[model samples]
Target: MNSTSSSDSNGPKSFSVNFNQDASSLQVGCRNGYRLYELSSVDSLELVYSNGAEDSNLVERLFCSSLVAVVSLTSPRKLKVCHFKKGTEICNYSYSNTILSVKLNRSRLIVCLEESLYIHDIRNMGVLHTIRDTPPNPSGLCALSINHENCYVAYPGSSSIGEVQVFDAVNLHAKTMIHAHDSTLAALSFSSSGTRIATASEKGTVIRVFSVVDASKLYEFRRGMKRCVAISCLAFSLCGQFLSCSSNTETVHIFKLEDPHNSPRRSVEESSWMGYLTNYLPTQVTDVFTQGRAFATAYLPFCGVKNAIAIATIQHQLRLLVATESGVLYIYNIDPNEPGDAVLYKEHRLDAVPENFDKTDKGRSSSPQNIEGILGSYAGIVKGNPPGQMSGTESDKLREMAAAAESPPKGAFQFSDDQEYPPLTQISD
Candidate 1:
């Protein structure tokens, strides 16, 4: 899901900042503004800087704009969004009660308040629709997001018991629901492509991935040493092959999923301490960058899938640094000429300033549509089982055989539903 604002002709003064685009260049953004510097060689892009205050009316909290639109309502005591190039006011709609969560879809508007979930049409300003599509007396929503293409909607729920659900973002349909844990679900996120889903819960920081087609659980993860850690933020790499999520305890866990099929790469960064893990796995040395003290996550758009990831963490003096959980954000540079595998980038934190709208774009379509396709042929079944204690070899083989026989690669199945199905009579959603 995404939080976006259009720019008007008279927005902030336009600046043509030419970037190195190479891995060696350093870029930064923060309370101050944006700036660039060279890696090994001493050089700077000496542009006049602006320390602007943040936009007050803008609220989408956490913004992840790939194919899906992801936003949250956790800070500022109100909804807030990431600042965009044009601007950062994704939606004009407001709520009467405390906003629990917000999701910016490519084609729809979905928000979850303290007690219910809502689906709206981005095209018409009027209420296109509403769905209390959750269990009654829902404690509240912690996180929310739509797939990159806005095909499905996901939200984390932790009420009397904890759980998470993936629904048809368009029709408010409950396609498949998982009774994930005996505890509450802490976070919900989707791969940038909208093909995979991840949910972290209090049940020992277990991160579960599911296929979009059947909404069935696929890969099971035992990610880190932090126990009972709940996820605070999630960011998918541009290529969708890697996922970065941070927890309250100043720990970021990077899980690599197999490309295309998205099968769990099976190798999770078991610990945030980067320097030593490299001794065992060579390619995984990158995990060291995520070693920051804290994080406010925002994914950057780059050409590669796993290379570009931006995370913001709160420091003692309100400083922000871009890092993966590997601690590499601080010392590692993508530049070959830079010293060490660790390259530290900079962040721009100007004196909080409101965005100048004179040159921003605010043109919004009455109805925005990001329908990739109706979910079809996507199916998987996961029964509650303790983490290890696998069935006997014979049983495991049988299970694998059964799984192979029935479960084809999920992408092969197609959603044949005509989407045009007339509304059901007296819909009780």
Candidate 2:
């Protein structure tokens, strides 16, 4: 799999023959400007997908190890959210031109574009409402996150007591703004049951988890080392027994919120993708990221969907884009339900792609494309990531406790041509 780069920096790039793991009987659309490679090695590896099909000069590839959803975003602005089962397009939602601030439930997505917040339903790629709580600023929409009922999310001009501004996911309306952090807040998360909320800011490094019902500080955790290090990302475990946070330190901290009286049990872990950039991203281009430094920080920071958190960084360095709007993708296993080592299992990237992919009338319309196939199956779905063996942390003691039993990490989703992960049927366009 050894390889080297050529002078044609932003052009056709290759991967180490060792890492190529596309399906064996791979085929390409003759009219499509893409090709698939088969790696004799890496048997159980997920089928690596490349996206330079439209044009070789600009290319992108993507792969998912767990719950895979088909979504689309335009570089210039507008975002198209789509939900797919096997290979069919279920429905797509188009939102106004703005940076997609947050995507909550599979069907609940918040796109804070331009001067407003848009509630879109991937159920059929449609926009429910365009709520303009605050006027748009040149800085662009900062950030947003939705709650369980798809009700509220944190918004701008928020206050110390105002942890998050609740929103009506069904109708774009001003729900309520809860008094939260002491300083300019950076990120927010609602406890699983929607009974509590957590806030962090430039001034507050420790995440102050408070009860939404009483607006009382339930517990506080000291986060990062630097100043104004707000909690960049946060999420609660499935059973609502633990809380996890990631920061500018590029570290993922998992906390066992098992002990109600005591603080939540927390552990710190780093991303494993740090090496891939050197392993894959740097080959095509040399700028933006140094030998090891990725162009962008990992993102979504919290993905409970796969019972794991996802990290979006830059990659396939050959064709690089400096826009903060562009980033890579990676996933890891941090099951709050499980008691054991925080395993950072899967890592992937959305290959270096061109801006107008689905933009022009010609290509796939900024709307992502899918192969027609099944929705799901029992064979490929990996199961059992948590047991009851582990518990507790130093400062934040976990209150939740269970019996000692363990389950294996879910196997990678297997994608094949005939019946890719059978049972996963397309929702419907």
**Which candidate has the highest TM-score of all?**
1
Over 1-429, each residue of candidate 2 has an lDDT whose tens digit, in order, gives 011222212223222111101112121211233333222222222223333322221111212111122223223242321121222222223334535343444334455655566664532223466667554333332333323353454464443333456655655566666565555666666654556666666563566676655556666655544573434456554345556665534345555554433322211111234334445655434222221111112233332111112212113111101111112223334433344444433333323333433323322332232222111221111111111111123101111111100211223233332223211213321
Give the residue spans of candidate 2 off by over 4 A.
1-74, 83-96, 102-107, 121-126, 133-150, 157-163, 171-173, 228-230, 260-429
Candidate 1 residues lying further than 4 Å off, grouped into runs, are 1-58, 61-94, 133-150, 259-343, 350-429
Scored by lDDT, the top model is: 1
Q: Against the true structure, candidate 1 has what lDDT?
A: 0.38
lDDT of candidate 1 over 189-300, digit per residue (tens): 6765677777767654566677767767665555455575545555554455445555534334454554323222112333334435565655534333222211122322
RMSD of each: 18.6, 19.1
CA lDDT of each candidate?
0.38, 0.36
TM-score (C-alpha, index-matched) for candidate 1: 0.48
